[model samples]
Target: MKKKIRIYQSINTKIVLVIVLLLVFVLQLIGANFITQIENQLITSFQEDRKVQMDFLESTITSSLEIEESGEGSETSPEQEISSLLTEFSGSGITDLQVVNSELIVMGTSDTTQQSTVGQLSDDVDLRQAQITENSITRQVIDSITQNRRWKIVEPVFSSGEDSQFLGAILMESNIESVYDQISQITWIFLQSSAVAIILSLVLANMLSRALTKPIKEMQLQTREIAEGDYSGTLKVYGEDELGQLASLINDLSDDVAEAQESIDAERRRLDSVLTHMTDGVLATDRRGKIIIINEMAQSMLDIDQETATEKNLLSILDVEDDVTLRSILEKQDDILVNSRQNDIPIILRASFSLIQRESGFISGLVCVLHDVTEQERIEEERKQFVSNVSHELRTPLTSMRSYIEALADGAWQDPDLAPRFLEVTQNETDRMIRMIQDLLQLSRIDSGKSMLNLEIVDLTEMLDHVLNRFDMMIHSAEYEDKKYQINKEILEQSIFVEVDPDRMIQVLDNIMNNAIKYSPDGGTISGKMEKREDTVLISVRDEGMGIPKADINKIFSRFYRVDRARSRAMGGSGLGLAISKEVVEQHGGHIWADSTEGKGTTFYLSLPYFPYEEEEWE
Candidate 1:
């Protein structure tokens, strides 16, 4: 946006003022010099005319004084003739005229107001000086009464002889104010002409300035319009001068800018599209770490709205300000695992930071790419846990078998009782390890989706009855003589046939029944049921034993997860039965879950797809 240019600040006004001032200064100097020379010439000419008149008056007065000195008589006395001559000699600019004798006595006077000074000693200093020195004297003075300028002249009259005698002196006073008045008039005329010249100069300067600044003003308007995204206007070139060349440049600049604008807009749209479709959340910040641009993915990942995220500090928005600072991130330029929660659900984000730097190596801001790593991190953690559990489980059995084998090898075989017992213990541990390894391999295959089920149609109720009969037989066997238990079966009259992998389905039921028997107390009844539910059949195994905690019930199906690790290990359970059962049931298009309460009992349910089948077709 262009600012409004004040009239006084405009280049046109400046040029006009500069030209006018230069003219004024030149005129002032010329006028002063012209007036001074005119005044000097006028005064010099006036003095020369006054000197001529005084010389004429002195010669005429000398003839009259000499005649008196020779005692010659005339029609009038010498004083009368001198007075007549003085009166005739006096003219304009002459204020007073006096004739004095050699003795400095006034002989004649022309001023009527000073006629009484005749025959009196002349008190005029110039008159007395002229008689004593026998030379003329002239001086100009201002009259105190009229405040007018006057010139006083005293000329000594000499007789015409080889030895001239100073007869007397003629004194004259002349008003010379007219000389200065004429000089003043001439100066005034010069001033009037200078003023007119200055007026003319001002007008010419304005015209010249307009010619020079017209194209410049147009260029200014054109540039302003270009800045406002209007590149249609072109500056009119007035001449082939500098301003015209500049106007041409401006026109070229507008064309270049229009092309650049289109290119920039296309690039911006492409960038916006890329940011919108990016799977990874991306955010950009200014040098101050304030969020400048945040894409939709970034907003979603951060769980922030566009309005709330704008201009907000990036670290604060990511909730990592306490642990990480912008400077640290910029300096390190490393990826940060940001542990955060959105809507109370814990999530992990891999925030990769990079510097937005210029070619000059100036760090302008930071760009952060946020990748939601919550599921990845969870899977990674589970992998680590699985490795550790497998190591520990293998280590326990291997360590036990190693101890028993070492005991037997170290002469324990000499004692038949000790050797057989150690051998038996070693074999049992080896079997446990083998079973664990098999379960681990099976789970790996299932997790990798490489396990295939041998699908078949099977009677869900008959499968449940077969699983219960085994548990019933185990309860009455000599091995469980001390631990009393009972089996309660609720089988539906109409058999529910489900499409399943028969072995896998039987294995799933075996895991449930075994868990029930292991956890049941003496005389505790293990209840089994088969029922058709919607288009599926549900088989539940209930145990009257201390149940799993509600918190850990959901996680009971995870590989190697045991609520009581010591008790489960002591009972020789591999802890993979339930995990395997879940995978098997799910693979056969069935679901398995457990319902439990602390200090109560647990019910494990398995639901498989059910279909009404005609047994005669198979027969």
Candidate 2:
């Protein structure tokens, strides 16, 4: 469980408390001293008043004594005169007044309750001390009988001569309770004032602390907003003080941070756009060779998950050797060609390395750009093979023609039979060369997308029949005098019409028939079939001969591809027939494919969009 904090513990509350406590302490100190001084002054004033009264009574008594000695008032006794003077001073604020003689005898006292003490020896210690010293003495005492606090003043009355004799001591006592009452009342007033002062101090301190802390609290809230990624808030300045200056700085900082964040976000968006649309794969790594940034192209090319690849080692993800880390690549500063595979298909990637460096020349990381050159490399290899195959194909017939021409020139023409045969052989070679050249030109046009088709609706059944009839005539010619071959046609009874280039379609059919004748054995039968589906016409040419291997079936339609190179060459096949046929069919918005079994036979299929036939058009 978390502990809860109290409001009094907050800075504002603490400040208020501190200010109040200090004020209270100081006020109490000053009030205590003031009260003490007032009490002392009051007690001193009371003592002075009592001393004046005692001096006056002493003067009066001394005057009376002188007159009595001079016989001016001889009728009155000296004790009676002193007693009447004491009586006069008794009720004049003094609690008690006494006149003692030189023998320590009680001459007179103003207290009526102490009348019996008259004419008795005074045992008062104040009087004894005053007679010995012959000086006035004052003392404060608590009355034992009445338990009242009082002041005692003793004055010695002296004669007016050079060696004055002490007549007696005048002892006076005054009750100090009135002075104490005034002090008590003043203390109460002081206590009440202190209480009021403390309350005012607390209220003033609270207000002052609140005024000081309000701006700080607002700044705190603004800072919190900034921490939460909102840099739009600005602090309000309270005064031209340090805290106000801090608020101004914070406001400026917020604006600066907001601008920096905007710039950073704009840069990030631009970088993302470039990475998203770029054709080449891009990968960035940290100084430690850990993956930091990877684009979609990189993920697709590397066959790795973007989320999973992040923070992983770059070399490990690329499947490169352990020594081929990003650090090593950066150090080498060279492009690397990585030969890798995806889904068992060979892929060649050209990876170019660049250093991500700081202005201080410190190498921070590496940037690797990967370009997939698999198709480019494959095309290059194919061009080389095409050139080689064309050279070999042309050289064969050219070599034969050269040899035969030289033989005829060497007098073989004189032998009539040998000359005609040699001429015949040269003509055949010339024809084969012409056929090869024609096929090459046709394929070149098709590949360049320059082949134009003369499209027309043709009767599919009639077209097949015409091609089959030509092959039937060729089989009975001198080329098939010993080998017996047959053409079997299984076409639709109803004539199907299709939109195609008739010449190109005838060429396509003738090429398929020639291949069938070349590969079929002596007595093998060739089957040709045409059928009309819902919206298309399907044509199939099959032969009972050596079938194509499944591995080479997909490549059979490629230019210069041959399952049996030697057999095809011996049969004067340039290996471009089916490739040309595929192009022609596709140019007519049709498709062509082959299906063959190794030990059974081979079949070629061609599909074209079917054209509807009307009776009026046929008429």
Candidate 3:
């Protein structure tokens, strides 16, 4: 398992190992430096001790010369004493010692081997070439004089006496045994420390690897949980460090994942409900051209009579590409289209997409939906047709009336008897056409929703009185002929003020009153009455005239739609009277209706909201 992990993993282990190896290498370098220092010091000490011994021996030889010059035991054999002294000094780091004289003759030596003598008299050929003057020391590795198995350190020496005289030179040859011993100790120390350090470093490396890998291992586990769609918080945090920050970020990511999952679930449920209830069709597909899901409406639309469209091809079922908008939206990573089409129908559907990314941030899948809006489009078309028809009907009559009026003014008035009736007829025709035009203009304004009404408080009683007086002359003239022809009005209360457009209210009442007068069938009673209710005031104009049938009641207020077209045309109905009245009532935020029994009478009621309905206005 360990080998497998290393093979498939990144180089984290390698980096740590490299760092540890560098540490061990530096330690060994330090140890090597310490050993080198000890060796240099030892070598210097050995050389200095040898030089000191040579100096002491030279001083002893000089003392011997002085004793001889004083003539005290002058013949006591100087050679023997010098030889003994030199032999003793030979036991030191210097293996051999010799003294040479100025005569270049044989001098007392450290050994009686004759070849160990410093001068030529001893037959020591190598010793004769040794320097006699200019004191200097040098070391050489040559064959040892007494030992056949090793080499020696040969150091040359000179006396520091008069004439730099040849009191004789001192030569020392050191055995290589001590140098080998010192070198062996250093090598042993290097091996020992190297082994100990390697073992300790391995232990530390293992521990350090675990310390660093532990947090990352936890992170790997958390990442696996997230990948498996288990977003519950399980991140392990240690302390306030880089790794701690990573843990915090992971925990935050888990929370975000949970929230995202909830949002997706909610959106899914909402989408499902919408698909089930909506009259439109919905379809979803994946990135590789495979169908993911399809709603019932969509299935039915595409002639697919199954419970689902899962694992199918969308294009195979939905051969129609009329929904270009939805298709374009589905083509993007994420998009929304408000208007999409169907095969043979125009639809406005809202569609959106979400790109699915994998571990490497590559595209994975796609989703789509569709909707239908055919019925709503048909209804709107019908309304537009109706408006156009109404316009035509109103315009035709006005056009004809204007033609005759122009004709009558230009020549029909030339004949006196013909001219009087013609001009009167023309005036009435003009008046009728003007009323139609005025009604048309009002209806047009209402249809266009452009008419702004200036509303104010209106006293119903005062308004009625003012309207009654406008026809006072006609009322008074007909008093002698018939009392029934005169207008009659009744009021139940005073201070009947309401919020209304006064002029529009007057126009509505005028239209009703004119219709009453023109189509009363015969002399009849024209009566007006006001009734107060909890929230509104009702104004009624009743006349013994033709009554409207129940079947036409619903359409009575439609523009250019008249009941009893022949009688309405004879009575000079503009066909927009009730329509304009309806518009005016609605503008004041009120209502108007008619109540009557055919051939009995007609009563048009205008209901208005009290200016301050909530207030105790009745008081």
RMSD of each: 4.6, 10.1, 20.8
When summed lDDT is taken over every stretch of 10 residues in candidate 1, the lowest stretch is: 610-619
> What digit string (tens of lDDT, one per residue) describes model 2 on residues 1-619?
2245489767898999899889888988898899999999998888878877766777788865555444565677888988887776766557888877776678788888989998899998888988888878887799899888888888888777787777677788888887898899999998898899889988999899999999988887888787678997878898989999999999998888888988999999999999999999999988887889999988878877788889587778777865475546777867777776666677899888888899999988888899999998889999999999899988999999999999999999999899999999999999998998999999889889898888887888999998988999999999789999999999788777777789999999999999989999889999999888888889999999999998999999988999999999888898999999999998888999999998678999999887687799877
Better of 1 and 3 by lDDT: 1
CA deviation > 4 Å runs, candidate 2: 1-221, 332-348, 405-423, 613-619
Q: Give the Å shift of residue 495 in candidate 1.
A: 7.3
Worst 10 residues of 3 by lDDT: 148-157
Task: Sort the candidates on TM-score, descending order.
Answer: 1, 2, 3
Q: Measured by TM-score, how close is model 1 to the native structure?
A: 0.81
For model 2, what is the alpha-carbon lDDT of residue 357?
A: 90
Task: Tell me the deviation in Å of residue 507 in model 3.
Answer: 59
Q: What is the TM-score of each candidate against the true structure?
A: 0.81, 0.64, 0.41
Show pairs that collide, candidate 2: none
The residue ranges of model 1 lying beyond 4 angstroms of the native Cα positions read 65-75, 98-109, 117-140, 151-171, 283-293, 304-334, 342-344, 351-368, 411-420, 454-481, 484-506, 509-513, 516-555, 581-619
Clash pairs (backbone) in predicted model 3: 100-168
Tell how far residue 61 is off in model 3, in angstroms. 3.9
Candidate 3: misplaced stretches above 4 Å?
Answer: 1-4, 7-19, 62-79, 100-133, 140-162, 239-245, 268-619
